[model samples]
Target: MKNEVKHVLGLSGGKDSSALALYMSQEHPDLDIEYFFTDTGEELEEVYEYLSMLEGFLGKPIRNLDPDRDFRFWLTQYNNFLPSAQTRWCTKNLKLKPFEKWIKDEYTSQGYTVYSYVAIRSDEDFREGLSSKNKSLVTKLPFKEVGVDRQGVFEILENSGLGLPKYYDWRSRSGCTFCFFQRKIEWVGLMERHPDAFEKAKSLEKSALEHGSPFSWSEGETLDELSRPERVEQIKRDHEKRLAAVARKRVVNPLRPDEGMVDLDEIYGQQKICLACHK
Candidate 1:
């Protein structure tokens, strides 16, 4: 008997993943792909809005794979320690687990050869692709295969009228509102735009510190210290200096005003982006 096959793509509400969905739909219309978003329950409002916009273009509903337990519950499970780059319990529990569970129960266990699509762009290091232990579950990097780099992703979103997510104006990547991978400037952006979320992160960090957790949401200092008026100004100035440096390095296109746009990752130096969270 021929083995059954299933195609699935996960969206992180970031430009690359959203663009991949559009690319797949436009280029390979015959392949039925199941697009899903694994909700951490701490995602920004803009993420939902962007996902909705993507759905309209795809003419299909993207499945929301919400975890059985939310971020708070998982935080408690990890003894209230804030997830850090060194220890990322949040991504495992809040993002990957739910998607894995859904895939295992629905496809793999039923003997389906699952083709999981990931949005690792061509410009990025190929080592960033998410690997699976299951032999039947194959990871496919369509962007890398098709040579769709950062600029190509921008064009895809631009041509599709989906554009980038609204949060792109402030935050570079999309995931939990209080993602630890965020730059100091992005935390500042969060504070300026979503004060409540910033406060919640502060509260969580306070609790974590009180409970003997070493990690702060931001690397060097607590949110309280970071939020001080003078410190905020310092962060802004530093970010501006870095932004200027990056801008000076790039060759600008006069006709395309949007050319050479820089993201937090570009300014802050590239980070090991969370595939399940930031993509």
Candidate 2:
């Protein structure tokens, strides 16, 4: 084993990871940190566009770690089962596998102690399953170490002029356009903003159901049922009602005035996100 270390970071095209890229570049300029994005090929166009803008700011092309097999291939391998919170074959194959392969082939075999910088904010708990079992692969949380919370994440992006991804205007979490982790409201946002992607998801869900897969992209109802005019209106009304309730209960934090802003995660509650794909 060589007495050396490699520093690397992954960008999820979300605010937190993007901000971490900017933060590291500014705070630790001397470290030659390699940045990469694991593309699932099913992501939003806005994700790609935002990453392009990020490249101009970083002055280094973020490497794309494309999986060897596409999503369709994996779907077939899983007998047309759509990945869900209970059965997340999508993240396993499309996100984590590629990164694990790259590190094992390029860095670990080359005898480098690889430090992976993850964007787990200080305010968030150290979620289960984030730790690496491989002795050579070390996971580091700079945000947690430095006490950079959700507020700090925004400040970093705003100061860097990267603001947030365009999808933030409608959708909240970052990952595949049809990520099952999405809330019902986010699915509606997808249907309105990117109908093509929404249709693709609907088609995929239909196929999955026909093949006896128990999971739908959205909980309880299939996309076909969810996309109906009546159901869409019902979802909208429920969303608005929740929003009003949250507004009424919100206590203004003087130190963090922006806390009053409605967070999508707050409305639906934070789901168990894919660490690799989201951050």
RMSD for each of the candidates: 1.6, 1.2
Scanning candidate 1 in windows of ten residues, the lowest lDDT window is 126-135
Q: What lDDT score goes with residue 71 in model 1?
A: 92
Compared with the true structure, what per-residue lDDT tens digits does model 2 show for residues 141-166? 99999999887988898889989899
lDDT of 1 at 104: 86
Cα lDDT tens digits for candidate 1, 91-121? 8888878888888888898999999999999
* Clashing residue pairs in candidate 2 (N, C-alpha, C atoms within 3 angstroms): none
Whole-model alpha-carbon lDDT for candidate 2: 0.90
Clashing pairs in 1: none
TM-score of each: 0.96, 0.97
Total backbone collisions for each predicted model? 0, 0
Once fitted onto the true fold, the runs of candidate 1 whose alpha carbons sit more than 4 angstroms away are: 126-129, 253-258
